[model samples]
Target: MTKLTLSLAIGDYDRARPLIDGRVQVDGVDLVPSVLSPEETFFRAFRHAEFDICELSFSSYTVKTSRDDCPYIAIPAYPSRAFRHTSLYVRKDRIKRPEDLKGKRIGLPEYQLTANVWGRAILADFGVMPSDVTWVRGGLEQPGRPEKIALNLPPEIKIEQAPADKSISQLLSEGDIDGILTPRMPSCNLTDPNVGWLFEDPTAAATEYYKRTGIFPIMHVVGVRKSLADAHPWLPGALFKGFQQAKALALDLLADTSATKVTLPFVEEQLVRAKELMGDDYWSYGIEPARPTLDAFLKHHHAQGLSSRLMAPEELFHPATHEAFSV
Candidate 1:
């Protein structure tokens, strides 16, 4: 088999380190992975088709898939997954509860971001529909943030652009926006006492959410260029196996408490608790195992008008990556 060398833009996650470092191989493919932040990777990948493979936003991918003009075909390898309970930032005075966000001016980096999709889904569970809040879109810490892909939001969902001179951080601090649904805190949040997270203890909220709905929000998935996948059909499955193996290696390293692989204390305790709540494959990569989460995301994606049509879990990835044959 001739090995194809391709550029892959991905995050510098511990689970994906093995693949980038050459410790793991993707069948016959030779990967040249450039680890980058989600913002840069997803933006370039969608905007310019910059890399052959990269981590793409699930919401954006669903949106592209619906249009049937997607340049990339997704794989089952989800490199990033979080509960998203900590994603919201609200003024302590105006927004005390989730329902209080109704009719408020809510700011976000982008409406179609994976984190925003999950955040809206959770908020809707509390009876706050996407149309309920007036959406203010802009950068979180800086200026000139735009949606990764085009969106045709429904008539009821009202969205406005933030002034080019200001960012969401400034908007929140000045009380121009009542709250923000974002993946991270505003820039002034650390220095200013006026801005704070909507959920004080997001971990507790995430745990309770998991307990209630059994949903672990997925953020990003591996995407391969559709043309490349079409030319080399084996590539998708190979990529899946490589990522799966890389994650397996990381998990094994996590269990090795002898040297304390990470700087964080209570590694063993947190691992035990996480496993108890989400099971061993909490950071899972597959169709069947993640069916519920995928289905939930697709439902919210369509309900929120991120997708023109309701996409299925199976439609997100290449058909070959769905199942494997074992000896």
Candidate 2:
């Protein structure tokens, strides 16, 4: 009956809840779940080690800021029924093709974000060089904040301060920005009546690239401090079971219209988005990063110079747990 603290990002809780809700059992251990957003939860976890487990992005995992001793647990990849592809949105009347983006100013919420990273990679695939366009960095608070710059951006790219009063969407609507790189969600509709989608499937090219190069980018992952894992060896197993249970519950709910209707609005929206981006076959099972997937991610991480050395997927994750839950 050992109590294990499990932290999940707020944005991802809907999918993770069932695992820690006590329905899933692992070696007779029970998992207790707590949820928070990535920044708030991880920042606190790093300071106090308050939670035994947490969910984090692959980029965040590679960052120098993260604790070195944390061990990642691979979660099953559930086809994001609500997943949407990121798109390069431009003022419809202004730019009609990908080539038209040359010399155009593009607005980004932050450079360090996965959307930006993948967006840049996608642009490269389309024959756009880093120097061919102007990049604008947004969401700054004071005169200088190092977090303001996304990361590892080349010198040719210029960083402009976004307005303090308006949201990026608002700015795009005002025609202050020629284009933006964002997910294909309704909320990111560029606010401009003139704004239209330039690239329909930004990740498609990347996905193909990954399949070809065996270098897929990792988005989000569940992490546990190595100290906590050592203190409680059974904890990792318990968590894996909990996640399996959650995935089962999610699948069951998705199959039931009555249950789906009662779920959170965001969950419903995600389902729609996933279908649009990944198509109908996406929801057959959860999406878990397997060995090949992790290997692909590691290769890309190294190529991007995001990590100093390539950390083997086995080193970053719990070996036994991953094998037991191989998806």
Candidate 3:
């Protein structure tokens, strides 16, 4: 039988490294993997449908899915998951809490980014509606970055692009913006005295958030081009099984502390703490396991005027990945 040759673009994560390096392979498929940054991968994928399979921004995926125009169909293999408390940076003297963000100018790379959506959702929990703040959109490292997908936001939400010559990080450091909500830490935060975190203790805040919400937010999902999935109905299940095998291998390596797989100190202790807080399969993938987090994100995605309507967790993935067959 001839194998299907497909291009796969995803981040260079340890969990995905096995798939990238050929230790884990999708059944009857020849995967040509590209290890790219999320920004570049998402940009090329959304704008041009450049890859056969790729990691998609959860928020943008939902936006397109709700419109019924997405070119790719996703499986429930989440490649990126994060807590958003650490994603917000604010002016130390001007803003002290989430409530201080009201009526302020907050900078972001894009309004539809999954991280920013979660960041805004965190603020909403403090009674800060999307309409209460002016969002300044610009690139994080360079100027004039635009949203990968066109958004038709509601009139109540306000967003303006930063000057063509300035990045959001530059705007934040100069006090032109009161805060920045981004997936990446702005470089100026290390050098600028004015920049600091809104959550003084992000670890504690994130822990408390997990304890309260039971949500370890998902950022990215694995997508297969719709045309390809339709042609090869078995492909989505093969991809899901491949990703699960890769993730299990990575976790096994992480738990083996004989030489410390990661360079960080106290890796064992950190792993212990994570398991204690989030259970053994903390970074679980699949629709039902991640329903609450997905539902919460979909609610915020609609409420913040990104998605045209609210979507269910199952709607984000292909039907083949909804469940697995058992012996």
Candidate 4:
């Protein structure tokens, strides 16, 4: 039998390592994986439809799917998940709390990014609305970042593109911007004492957030070209199963702490603590288990004006991926 060979674009994630290295295989499919930064992967996938399967930004995918004209279909296999508490960085002396972020100039790599969406949602937790901030959009470390697709947002939201010559990092370093919301650590924060996390200890905030919301935020989902899923109805579930198996294998290896596979210390203790907080399957990818996080994100997407309409979790995934037969 000939396997369906498809191109897959994803980030270099521990969960995806098994699939990337061929330790886990998608049934009846041969995926040609292209591991790259989330920005590059998402940019190529959304802008040019460059991959048959790709790790996609949940926010942009929500925007596209809600239009009823998206070219792709997603499985609930989230390749990236991070608590947004760490995504906020502020000038050490300027913004002391989330409330201070209101009416302040906040720099972001992209206005519609998943990180920013969740960041805004958390800010709302402290009484800051999306419309309250004056937003500056630019690359994190480079210049000239633009929205991948057109945005039809509410008039009240304030967004301005940074000057073509300057990046968000540059603006933050020069104290031109009060804070930055980015998925990665800002370049200026590493070497400068003046730039620090909005939360001094993000772990505490994340723990508190988990206690309040019971949500470990979902970031990226795996998408296939809708046309491909339409033509080959079996593909979506097969790929989902493959990704699940890949994640399972990765986690199984992580459980083996006798010799310490990862370079970081406290691997065992951290794993135990995470399970204590988030349960056994902490990084779950199933539709049933992810409903709350997905629901919360949909609400945020709508509230932030990223989506033209509120999207239901049921409508966001491929029909073929909704269920699986167990043996």
Candidate 5:
């Protein structure tokens, strides 16, 4: 009869909503949502032992390096490429080809994100080393403070802070940065005549890498306290079910324009983006952490010196609640 409080970082809520809103109810559990960005929520929860279940970015876990006594059971998210949505977008006027990026300034939200990692890998694929380009940081550019997630930066990396008054988009428009490594927002377009898709296809190298390595660097994971999981063993199952329900709801809504009309603007945008990137498989239930993808991530982490040793997939994910639910 006791309720389980789950805290998830802000952007993560879309993925966690099903468990909180739908799945827990069928198992006679209650989930409460707490709004916080992944880093703030993670540190707060870890410091105060605040929530029963939570979600945090994998970069956060690697950067904090404070897993001891942490009650959270790390769960694999639905397997997807590490840089699924992130990419290196260039301006067509400046860079006629990916090779042309060799000496350009690249803008990143932060130097520590998987987006940067993937960007580096993509550059490597194009034969452009880190020394070949200038790295610029601090690109969140909206009118508010940036989210506090760990950037997973190496000691040697220097982050250039952007001016507080200017947004990254504004800089991009003004030609301050040659290209940016970030997700494409609705207002942004790779084919906009101004901006060019640098890699042509961002996932090509990743797909090949997946075939070579069986691990995928997981970007985000759902974490729940071990004690909470022990006390409420049904929580994972319920959470999974909730996600399934949410996926269904999202899909149904996507199908019916009327339903999407009621959702948040960002959520609607995310749904559209999800469909465009992931296709029909986006709504499938359960987490499917791609091993090959994680392996590639480990290599990048080591290359960047973010981690000395690669974490095994088992070390990263909690044991499956059941075979059917395993990802």
Candidate 6:
């Protein structure tokens, strides 16, 4: 067989390091992987279609997919996932609870960011809809950042671009915005006394939310170029199997007790607690395993005016990735 050669751009995550280092290889394919930061990878991929396969923001992916002009088709291999409770930063004196956000100004890097969508969904659960808050969109640390993809938001949803000279984090620090939905913690929260998390204990709040909702929000998915997938129908499944094997190896390394594979202490304890809370395959990657999270995100994406319509969870993934042969 003539192995297909392709370029892949994804975050330098432990779960994907095996593929990057060639410990795991996609069957019938030769990968030239670039381990880039998620922000750059998403921007280049969505804007220019620079790579044969890449990591994509789920929100932006859905927006393009719903428009029926997306350049790539995703597999169920989620490269990034997190609970979004920790993604929200607020003024301690102003936004004490989720409801406090109603009618307030909120700053975010982009209206179509996956983390912000999940963060807004958290507010919606508290009876605050997207329309209830005014959103200021801009870069988080630097000025002039734009949405990776265009969004056709509903008229009722309000989003304004921040001043060309300032970033969203600057707006939060200056008290121009009541709160912020961010993929990363803002430097203002570290230096400013008034900036804090709405959830006093984000970990506890996220755990409680998970217990109630069974959702581990997915941030990024792996996408193969549509032209490539169409030319080689087997590509999606090959990449899927490669990622699963890589993840299993990463988990095994984490479970090893002799020396912690990660820099964090109490790796074993955290691993044990995670399995207790979410089961053995907590960070599972597949349509069936991730349906609840996917469904919730799709609903929120549409409600927040990112998706053209409410998309089925399965629609985001390639058909070859929907199921695998069991022997």
Relative to the true structure, candidate 2 reaches a TM of: 0.69
C-alpha lDDT (0 to 100) for residue 47 of candidate 2? 49
Instruction: Quote each prediction's TM-score.
Output: 0.98, 0.69, 0.98, 0.97, 0.67, 0.98
Ranking by TM-score: 3, 6, 1, 4, 2, 5
lDDT of each: 0.90, 0.55, 0.94, 0.90, 0.57, 0.91
Q: Which one wins by TM-score: 3 or 5?
A: 3
lDDT string, candidate 4, 1-327, tens digits: 799999988888888988898989999899899889988888888888899999999988989888887788999999999999899999988888889988899999888999899999999999999999999999898998889888998999998898899999999989999999999899899977899999989999999998888778999999999989988898999999999999998898899998887999999999999999999999998788988898899999999999998878989898877877789
Stretches of candidate 1 off by over 4 Å are none
lDDT of 3 by residue, 137-236 (tens): 9999799888899999999999999999999999989889999999999998998988988999999999999999999999999999999999999999
Error of 5 at 223 (Å): 1.6
- What is the Cα-based lDDT of residue 284 in candidate 6? 97
Question: How does candidate 6 score on lDDT?
Answer: 0.91
Best by lDDT: 3
Q: Give one digit per residue, the lDDT tens place, for model 6 in 111-199.
A: 88899999999999999999999999888899877777777788999988899999888889899999989989998999899999989
Error of 2 at 123 (Å): 2.6
Candidate 1 per-residue lDDT over residues 1-327, each given as its tens digit:
679999989898889999999999988888988989998998898889999989998888889999998899999889999988888888887788898899999999999989999999989989999999999999998887878888898999999999999998899989899888888867777876877888889899999998988788889999999999999999999999999999999999998999889999999999999999999988888988888899999999999988999888888899989997799
Number of backbone collisions per candidate:
0, 16, 0, 0, 22, 0
Question: Quick one: ranking by lDDT, best first?
Answer: 3, 6, 4, 1, 5, 2
In candidate 4, stretches whose alpha carbon ends up further than 4 angstroms from where it belongs are none
* lDDT agreement of model 3 with the native: 0.94
